[model samples]
Target: MNQDLFDNVRRLVTTAAAGLAARRGEGLAEVLERLAQQDIGPGAFREPEPRSLPVLRHLPQCVGEAMVLDPRLASAIASVEDALQWQQSASYTDDLLGAGFSENYGWAEIIGPRGFFPGDDVLLGLLMLGPERHYRDHYHPAPELYWPLTAGSFWSRDGGPFVEQPQGAIIWHPSMALHATITRATPLLALWCWTRDTATPAQLA
Candidate 1:
């Protein structure tokens, strides 16, 4: 394990968490408070096998936009992009995401059971969706918070119609609440966290 790399990723996670903690919105304060109680010591982290998906091809462009919104967080992620292990949810297969959508969606766990830092029941990561893609409705036991770094993305919760959200927007999904995402024209990049009840994987609605 690269100690320096681990330290850098840890810094990025803390910086991003602090940034989210500063936000004023529904569910933000509660999630931030829970995050504050976690132990993020180096001992809690272990390097995992690195992986990537085709969607990552758009990462640089999305990160470019993210840099404008939050340079510290964006730069930190860019610095570790090459070393990060990007993966996708097993529940979302090509059949569920539509014909070619599977190729356009991917996520990387920065802090979780299988991530750089083994989270104490908390999960922090990045998610990306390519242009004109639909993630479809899905839900899990863990409550989720998403911080979209780029624009042109739409969000829907509990089977509601999708609504456009601009860069730096914050969206939260309560436990098992059906949620979905859509992107048009431009790719989508966002930071996500699952705070508590992390054992269950997401199920398609």
Candidate 2:
């Protein structure tokens, strides 16, 4: 494990949490509380082998775009990019999504069962979707929060219409609520967190 990489991830989480301080919402409150309880120090985590996915090919571009919106958060992400364990959902398939969906989507956990730090019931991570992709409706038991680092992304929740969310905007999804995401010409790089009920995985609608 690269001590510097681990520290960078820790800083990323810390920086993100700090930026959310002024946001008001029940979901955000719970996420902050859970994040507060996490110990991200050296002794609190086990190093997982670093990995990458096809979607990451666009990460540098996304991060660069993100810097224009939130330099602090974007730089935090860039600092730890090389050490992330990028992965995709085993249940997701090209047939279920789209022909190129497999190559366009992936996630990396910063805190959770599969993450560097084992968070009991909380999950913190990054989710990336390449250009012009639709991650159709999906639902999960846990409440979720997403802070998109880059722009030009649309999100839909609870069978609602898709709304364009700006860079650094926070999107929350309550437990079991249907949600989906779409990306246009620009790819997406977002920080996400699941406050509780982390046992169940997301199921597509």
Looking at model 2, which ten-residue stretch has the lowest summed lDDT? 19-28
Instruction: Give the per-residue lDDT of model 1 (tens digit) for 80-158.
Output: 8887888878778888788878789988888887678777788888999999998888899999999999998999998
User: What tens-digit string does per-residue lDDT give for candidate 2 at 5-94?
Assistant: 777888888888987776665478888999999888888867778899999999999989988976888899889888788989998999
Quantify all predictions' global Cα lDDT against the true fold: 0.87, 0.90
lDDT winner: 2
RMSD of 1: 1.2
For candidate 2, the TM-score is 0.95
**Candidate 1 local lDDT, residue 47:** 76
CA lDDT, candidate 1, residue 53: 88
Candidate 1 clashes: the total is 0
Residue 22 CA displacement from its true place in model 1, Å: 2.0
Residue 82 Cα positional deviation in candidate 2, in Å, after optimal superposition: 1.0
Model 2 residue 112 distance off true place after TM-score fit, in angstroms: 0.9
